[model samples]
Target: MIEFEFVKPSTVADAVKALAADGAQALSGGQTLTPTMKQRLATPSVLVSLNGIAEMKGVTVGGGVVTIGGATTHATVAKEASAYPALARLAGGIGDPAVRNRGTIGGSIANNDPAACYPAGALASGAVIVTNKRSITADDFFKGMFATVLDEGEIITSVSFPVPLKAAYVKFDQPASRFALTGVFVAQYAGGVRVAVTGASNNGVFRWKEAEAALSANFSASAIAGLKVSPKDMISDLHGTAEYRAHLVKVLTGRAVSAA
Candidate 1:
């Protein structure tokens, strides 16, 4: 990696101010960014570390919503988010021990990797991402692969997920990286049902509306009987073909629903 000044601020405001400097980039777990930096794909002049900020670290669940601090590590979430077992289980399975200890939920969501698990859980759970500036819904925060709608110098403070009546996440993982080859999240609320799919589309995580409609009518694995996922918008990659990913989406959604 190139020479870069590292700043660890103790407060969110101070960190935000530090990040205001030109060519300054935020650093959390370093699981994703560090690798890219080593490859020389990213060359920030300064690195602002958020791990030192005490206010942005913890997890809380009450009043029907599970709130997790932006800097809270995956291991903490796995232990704390018991109110939403689906989300907690998802967190626990994110990566190996070291990654779980170091990776932060905010970092994962901010990066918005197409194969990442958080996006699908957030989208299906109808999470609200709180930032230094404002609160953004998961639907609006994610734009595309490695993209989000966050403004410059805006840091994620926490994420609040509405506890669902029933929800589950099932993923077909890519062996080497453990990133989802295809993942499905199914959530049933009193109002209706939400189904989100990830790691299968080039456009990134998207709602499986047809599956949602099917499950809304009848919430069961058999509800999705004869349901089809077209390969038109799915991703074609070295790990699997578009058709293969499409099939996994259907199968995984059914499994999630059954488990839920």
Candidate 2:
């Protein structure tokens, strides 16, 4: 590991200020960040620890919407299942207990790992990412693999998800690590339907407009039958072939809709 200075900022303003310093990186749960540091893949000159900031650490539900602090852990979300069962399920499905206890929502989204489950939830639920600066829509937040619209020194404060009428997440794990080889999130709201897929695409997360259209017409498992996803766009690796993942996308979408 590279030698670096660590700064634990007690407030959001301080954290942001620290992050503004040259070659600075934000640390939340450190589930992904620390490992990268140890591997020498990431070597920030300064580490701005957000753990000291009390403002970024809770879950709130009001006016039919759910607001989650960026630093909120997956374990907390899972333990508070009664608040949003589907979201809790999504949280519980990430990594293992130790990881869930340490991995955070902001960390997950900020990293934007292709196989991470939270991005699917955010995209499907039309969640808003609230940062120290401006709010970004889920669609506009994710750029690509391990990338987001977050600028230098920007710190995500919280995420706000509008409560849906019904929602569910289904995923096929990669076995050893339990990372999603292919995952799907389906949400049915009064306005319409939203379907988001993760783990299969190189682009990280993407919407299934065809499936969404079909579900909006008739919110049923059979509704997704006519939707076809091209294998050409999916990622092919040791877990499964691109063709196989394409098939899983359709299969998982069916299962998610049926369960919903």
Candidate 3:
């Protein structure tokens, strides 16, 4: 790894200030970024660690919502987020034990890896992405694969998820990486049902509106039996074809709804 100055800020304000410097990069959990740095794909002059910020490292549930600190790890969520069982289940299944213990939710959301589980959970749960500057709805926060509206030096403070009446997430793993080849998260709330698909779309995690509309009318697997997901916008790669992923979108949606 390239030599770089490292700073561990105890507060978000200090972290933001440190990140404002040119060539500074935020380091959370070090699950993804560290590997990139070692590979010379990322060579920031300064590395600002978010792990020391106490405010960004816990879980709280109240008033029909679950709030997770930005720096909270997948293991933390899996252990402490009992109120949102589906979300906790999703967290528990993210990866092997080592990854679950080290990967932060904020980093996952910020990276917005198309095959990552958190984006699907956030988008389907109608969660709010809280930042140092302003709060953004999950719908507006994600821009595309490995992209978000977070500006330079901006930090995600926490994420607030409005607990749904019923929800479930199901994914077909990509084996070696355990990343999703195609994943679906289904949430049913009083307002309506929301279905978000990840690991399948070329544009990143996205809502399946047609399935949502059908499931909203009837919260059951059969509700979306006749519906189909177009392969045109799906990702085609060595693990799976666009057509195969698109098919999984529908199949997994059914499994999720049934599981929910």
Candidate 4:
């Protein structure tokens, strides 16, 4: 990796200010960014670490919402976020012990990796992404693969998830990385049901509106048993074909509903 100035800021404001400098990049868990840096793909002049910020490192639940600090590690979420059992379970399944101990929910959300597990959960839960400047809904936060609406100097401070009446996440693992080959999160609320799919699409994490409508009417595995996502939008690679991923999406969504 290239030489870079590293600063561990104790507050979100300080971290945001530090990231305002030219060529400065905000560093969260470093699970994703560090690898990119080592590969010489990203050469930031300065690294602003968010781990030291005490205010951004805890989990809280109240008034039908579960709020998790941006700097909170996966291990912390897995251990503490009991109010949202499905989300906690999702956190616990990310990568391995070392990665779970180091990877932050905010980092995972910010990176918006196509195969990452958290995005599907967030989208299905209708999460609100809180930043130093403002709050954004999960639907508005994500743009596309490896893309988001986050501004240059803005930093996500926390994420607020509306607790669903019933929810579950089911992922078909990629084996080596443990990243989702095709993951589905199903959440049923008082209003309706939400279904989010990840790791299968070229456009990144997205909602399955057809399945959502079907499940909203009848919340069961059989509700969407006949539903199918077109293979055209799926990501095709050596691991699996677009058709295979498309099939997994339906299968996993059914499994998630059953699990829920």
Clashes of each: 0, 0, 0, 0
What clash pairs does model 4 have?
A: none
Question: RMSD per prediction, one decimal?
Answer: 0.8, 0.9, 0.6, 0.5
TM-score-better candidate, 1 vs 3: 3
State the displacement of the C-alpha of residue 226, model 2, in Å, after optimal TM-score superposition: 2.1
Residue-level lDDT of model 2, residues 1-260, one tens digit each, is: 99999999999988988998899999999988998999999999999998878899988998888899998999988876456678889999899999999899998998899999999999999999999999999999998778899988788899988888888999999989788999999999999999999999988899999999999999999887777889987999887999999999999999999888
What is the descending lDDT order? 4, 3, 1, 2
Per-residue CA lDDT of candidate 4, range 18-83, in tens? 999999999999999999999999999999999999999999999999999999999999999999
Candidate 2 lDDT (Cα, whole model)? 0.91
Worst 10 residues of 3 by lDDT: 225-234
lDDT of each: 0.93, 0.91, 0.95, 0.96
The weakest ten consecutive residues by lDDT in model 4 span: 220-229
Looking at candidate 1, the ten consecutive residues that score lowest on lDDT are 144-153
TM-score of 3: 0.99
Query: What would the per-residue lDDT of candidate 3 be over residues 1-260, giving only the tens digit for each residue?
Result: 99999999999999999999989999999999999999999999999999999999999999999999999999999999999999999999997899999999999999999999999999999999999999999999999988999999889999999999999999999999999999999999999999998999989999999999999999999999999788998999999999999999999999999999
Off by over 4 Å in 3: none
lDDT of 1 by residue, 1-260 (tens): 99999999999999999999999999998889999999999999989999999999999978999999999999999999999999999999997889999999999999999999999999998899999999999889889888899987789999999999999999998989999999999999988899999899988888999999989999999988798899997899889999999999999999999989
The residue pairs that clash in candidate 2, if any, are: none
> Please, what is the TM-score per model?
0.98, 0.98, 0.99, 0.99
